[model samples]
Target: MTSPTVSVKRVSECFVKPQHDHSQDAKQPIYLTPFDLPFLNLNYSQKGLLFAKPPPSENQHFSITTFLNNLRNSLSATLTHFYPLAARLATRKQQNPPSYVIYIDPENSPGVKFIHATVDVSVSDILTSTYVPSVVHSFFDLNGAICHDGHTLPLLSIQVTELTDGIFIGGSVNHVLADGTSFWLFMSSWSQIFKSNVNENACFVSRTPIFKRWVLEQHDPITSLPFSYPDEFIERYERPQHLKERFFHFTTASVSKLKTKANTECNTEKISSLQAVSALLWRCVTRARHQPLNSETICKLVVSNRGRANPPMSEDYFGNPIGSVSATTTVEELMAHGLGCAALRIHEAVRSHDDKAVKTQVARWYRNPVVYKMSGLLPPNITHIGSSPRFDMYGCEFGLGKAVAARSGMMNKGDGKVTMYPGREGGGSMDVEVCLLPEYMMDLECDEEFISALIEE
Candidate 1:
């Protein structure tokens, strides 16, 4: 199928000043948790496009131009609450001891970039297609350079694309500043502002971001830290390879069946829907790779620490509040035991994450100071699963209506990476975007068990 054409109409920068004074404490360094160091030298960014239906009338109140203006205005106001997002990352080298911090120099740093574009296609043209369109990348302005010195870049960029029948709101945010959950918080807040009307009086966002540096600093003092990009990590990231991204839909009914089967096989252990679905995907991909039977494989589940913190951190604490939990097993054991065993392993791994474990992990990283090396650890046998099925990606309404479709650009089609989102159909379904080599993807498509488990309608 031919890809849609997207033309950039205009490009401009948007600087949003905070509503309140943060100058007194703006220079203090916001210490990076052990979780944030690995991403320090990486230029990883996430891109998501939210599609909204066309307005009901052509009145000035509902015109496309007015909508864009409202979005920009609300975004500027939203930044007031999420002030750190409008700030830049910097390291103080001239100090007796250099300190890493986020600099909110309103006079210096250019705020987030906002792009205006038009697409020569309809929302249905891209959504109804079998695979995601390549033109989707045009909706985002990704960071192309690899940062080795922790050089600062725009923390966020937003592109609003006008489609033939709808509007596409795309956002690109640096991963070093926030993870998937925090990123969505910003997006959700922007939508709330728009929904509440971009009037001057309605400037406050529903959720206020907590930028207290003391929360993490008290646990681990801010100091000069060395950043390293291992050769293996560099090679893996820079390797030349072509990848395909495909979305597989699993309906609520189908998921229930899988959960039932998985639990029955594991003596009715009451495995969650996420664990069951993850296990199914793990099994399918492992079989597709056709790895040696005795080879050990692992699934790294990205777990959020919002509620796992002692007394629990605020829902809007922000930053990268995440850690990984792994479920490891041999290829032989996984294939022989089927879904139940894999599901049980996943359940155990997820259940292991708690307040004590999160604190202990942070303390360990604080003492060592060396970021964990993830490259070449398990070679092609590791599948890193990020994001969650619980996030309300579809509920992001910008006064028009709920989003009809959403897609992520940071989800690269690497060897073994997968991201899950809540399906648009809205009955507790899931949309699993799988990224793998061409051959393995083909094998997964042909797997009878995997095909049978999907909702065919």
Candidate 2:
């Protein structure tokens, strides 16, 4: 039987520009490093935070209008710091290979698009499910608009979906402007501003955006991709596999055990918590696929390149300071070898991507660049992990209270795409959000050997 249908209606829409004017940088092209250009053709990174609606008796004065007013005003203030986000990407057609660059003309540029919508669903309907309802996807805007579309699209768009008993705040950020780290940083700062205003006496120290693009001396102030576009569709053509998604919650204790077990088997060097979790999902997903023992399987782990840069860039430095390392092995080797063996492979690959290696990767990209399409990046059934549990998603407290749940929109999503978030209870706990083929997800949910481990759900 079909699950209950869900629908949403927009209550209002408006544009919120930065509280301060930044027209001085209007025609100046904002720098887009080699690391940032790759995301130009990709869709915005979409994520949402759900909060429980306060009861009427708790605050009779509370109204959606007032709440949104505060939110919009706070956002305007926050944009003053993250001024780059308020800008749009403009193409330089005169160049031999037309290029895209971020340009901000506050006087004429459209501000961040803000929409208020209401969903016909309950708080329980969203928080209680192991598998998120697909309809929740509508809670966000800019569904198919790629970062390249930022030439005309809002660099950042926000949608607040009001549920009967909760509120889901979703945001779509142009990937060319920020990575997961920068995205969450913006969210956390927005929350702080909102809370500070709600309680006037509260310390309202505004966070600063570390817009240090000079770290990459090789990157030019006027950026352009190594390759020209318009060939080999930039958009993704997903597989025919019936896709399904599920959130796998691992407790701090369970994560510890996974780490301990991985370290014991791969005893040469201690594996990290991230490595263990990635290994577990890699092994289980491959098992569920039930492929031939000889079939090759690969796991691409997305890692931040900031720490690997020369002089080691600041952790708070904004923009896409990201890189990836791939670990490969045969299905037979992966399945027969167990989690420890798989983890060791991942650990070794990660360990080898030192500062020099990261520089080399960036340099190579400078010589030869490929406009990436989400679907074709990896072979079938191969795991590509993005995002991380380390991001402080729960720390975002926007007067409404702590978020009850965290979710990603239907952007950059396809089979084998996994994003990790810190569990609401924190304390080293991890939440692995997995997307896979329906049959594979079913088998994974039932895989006794895999589920036997210490997993919360």
Candidate 3:
């Protein structure tokens, strides 16, 4: 049976420029850090949707018109601090040597695009659906035309979709411009401004973004290393579209149970909830795939380096401060060692990314600046996990109360890809979204161990 499709009507589209002018640094190009280069060829954006129910009282002045006006105004104000987001990427035309640079050409560059849309489907219809709804994809502006080339695309695009019961504010930010933390920081700030009714004085000063690009730069001159261009990596990393996405909710109690089980197996060290959950999923997904016993399987864990910087970079410091750490084991070992072994491997891989290690890695990349070859080539038996359950996505409010739920529209949705989100109620509960080929998904659904771990909502 086919799931119902929501009809989305675009009401308006316009570019929202920064309220303040930043022409002084217009000609200067923000050079891409070695960390930012891997994302250059990847036109994919980080898409998030925040859903909020309508105002409670009829006497409330918060109508859709007022809400949108406030959002537009607030976004304009917020962009002043996040000016780089309003700019575009400048790529090398033939003879240009440095590859690509972000040009803050306020005069000619197109600012972030703002779109107003309406969906006929109600919010409850979506929340109650068994499968991941297609409407969630429509909420964001995922147009290929807008994100085809790093040079032409706006660094950010936002769509405000109104429904019968609530509203969905969808955001698509260029991956090169920011990481998950930076993205959420911008979002939280936007919500603050909207909640304050666009009052300039009410804007939180402490949350201001630092736009200095050199903070991540090394003091000494670094030797240039050879790197693959976006064209060379496109086909290798392109996600397969023949997979299905499903959301599995795990309550705090279930998470504790998994953690306890994993710890009991590994007598020396205790693994985190994140590691435990990843281990469980990794084991289940790998088994579902039914690969050869000797085949090597890898779980690519995305680790945030915010706290691991030598001096510890400020939590508010924007840009990508993230790196991938992987736990590798043979299929036979992974299946035989139980969840504790996999969890321990994951825990250690993450623990190894301490301050000194993270700093050393950054410096090494600086001297030999190049995108990792592992990024584009995900051979069979490999999975890349992005996002974290720590982010307070459900806490974001915009005058209409807190968000009921959140989901990623632009995350990689191919086989062995996973993204995690904090549960709506937000204790230690988690929402794990998994993507897999139909056969593997079918196997996963039938696995008794996997089914037993899930906490049915």
Most accurate candidate by lDDT: 2
**Taking the tens digit of each residue's C-alpha lDDT, what string does model 2 give over 155-240?**
89999998888899999999878889989989988888887783334424355667757334556555555334444336744434
TM-score of each model, in listed order: 0.88, 0.93, 0.89
TM-score of 2: 0.93
Off by over 4 Å in 1: 4-28, 52-62, 94-109, 145-150, 213-218, 227-236, 371-378, 410-413
lDDT of 1 at 363: 77
Q: Judged by TM-score, which candidate is best?
A: 2
Q: Give the runs in model 2 whose Cα sits over 4 Å from its true position.
A: 1-4, 23-27, 95-108, 198-206, 214-221, 226-233, 236-241, 455-457
Q: Which runs of model 3 end up more than 4 angstroms from their true locations?
A: 1-5, 23-28, 55-61, 92-109, 145-148, 214-238, 363-377
Instruction: Give per-residue CA lDDT, model 3, range 1-457, as digits (tens).
Output: 2245547899998999777777676435665555566555454555565565655674265577777888888998888777778887665433345332333344445788899998777767767776567667788875443232546767788998887667888888877568888888898888777676666565553487754453444453222234235554333345566677788899998888889889999885469998999999999999999999999999988877878876777778777667889999999999998889999999999988897777677677766665444345456798778888998676568776777778667344567888899887777999988888888989999987788888543
Backbone clashes in each candidate structure, one number apiece?
A: 0, 0, 0
Error of 1 at 136 (Å): 1.2
| Residue 145's lDDT in candidate 3 | 31
Kindly list the per-residue Cα lDDT of model 1 for residues 25-69, writing each as its tens digit: 654556565667655445455557566555556433467667777
